[model samples]
Target: MPKLKTRKAAKKRYKTIGGKRFIRRKAFKGHLLEKKSPKQKKNLAKPVIVSKQDTKAIRIMLVC
Candidate 1:
């Protein structure tokens, strides 16, 4: 059988603490910071868990 390859792009974008769950950075944090409030910016700084619906696909891409 051929070796399964991990998707490099998915590797860079997500991190799994353990098991199948993946942590990813929140969006809207990259730009337009000036207009964003302090609290909102702070909240956006944290990473969030990927939803259950998306977890399956990500697991396949990550080859977990």
Candidate 2:
């Protein structure tokens, strides 16, 4: 049987730590910053874990 290949895009954007997948947060470094609150800006800097429902699909894509 052929080896399963990992998704290149998923590999670049997602990271796995202790078998958990973390995705980079959006809208923090981009435009429209003035409309957002200070706490929102701070929170956006942190990475978000992939939801449990989606974790299985991401794991397959990540091949981790």
Candidate 3:
């Protein structure tokens, strides 16, 4: 069997923590920051874990 290749984009955007959970950067904080409120911007700064529904797909993409 051929080895599975990790999705480069997913590998770059997502990270594994403690070899169990996947962490990713919050969205909507990359551009047009002037329009978003201070609180909203601050909240977006934190990283979030992948949802249960999406975790499976992400894990496949990451080859984990």
Candidate 4:
């Protein structure tokens, strides 16, 4: 059987916890921060857990 390759882009975007699940950065914080409130920016910095519906596909990309 051929080896299943890991998707490099996905590798960079998602992080795993104990090889069981994934966490990812929240969107909308990438740019244009001046208009956003300090509290909103602070909350955006925190990582969010991948939704169960999306976890299956991400796991495949992660090859976890």
Candidate 5:
């Protein structure tokens, strides 16, 4: 049997919390802020949980 290697790219993008929930940065926060509203920019600053369907695949990538 062999151990699985952690995907560095995934490691940098996703974070595991309490071994159940996965947290990640919200998209569309970079650049082009001049046209975006204050509320939209504010919301993008927060981290969000990964979607249910995607969590399964993300978990595999985060495996230790």
Candidate 6:
């Protein structure tokens, strides 16, 4: 049988920690400090867990 290839797209977008999946928040691109509010900017610096409904699909994509 051929080796199962990992999904490159998923590998780039998602990260696995302690068997849980996390994805970085979108927006705040370039992280310019001249506009976005402190709270919004600080919040975007964190990683958020992928929802349970989406976990299955993400795992498939990640081959994890």
Number of the predicted model whose lDDT against the real structure is largest: 1
- The best-first sequence of candidates by lDDT reads 1, 4, 3, 5, 2, 6
Per-residue accuracy of model 4 over 1-64 as CA lDDT, tens digit each: 9978999999999999867778999999999999999999999999998888999999988787
Candidate 1: list runs displaced more than 4 Å.
none
RMSD of each: 1.2, 2.3, 1.0, 1.0, 1.3, 2.3
Worst 10 residues of 6 by lDDT: 22-31
- Encode model 6's per-residue lDDT on 1-64: one tens digit a residue: 8766889988887888778756645655565776888887778777787788888888887767
| Segments of candidate 6 deviating more than 4 angstroms | 1-3, 31-33
Model 5, position 48: C-alpha lDDT score: 94
Score every model by TM-score: 0.88, 0.70, 0.90, 0.90, 0.86, 0.71
Cα displacement (Å) at residue 56, model 2: 0.6
List the global CA lDDT of all models. 0.94, 0.78, 0.92, 0.92, 0.90, 0.76
What's the count of clashing pairs in each model shown? 0, 0, 0, 0, 0, 0
lDDT of 1 at 58: 94
lDDT of 3 by residue, 1-64 (tens): 9989999999999999878789999999989999999999999999998887888898999898
Q: Which ten residues in a row have the lowest lDDT in candidate 5?
A: 55-64
- lDDT for model 2: 0.78
* TM match of model 5 to true structure: 0.86
Q: Candidate 3 — number of clashing residue pairs?
A: 0
Query: Candidate 6: what lDDT?
Result: 0.76
Query: Roughly what TM-score does model 3 have, to 2 decimal places?
Result: 0.90
Give the Å shift of residue 39 in candidate 4: 1.0
Superpose all Cα atoms of candidate 3 onto the true structure and report the RMSD in Å to 1 decimal: 1.0
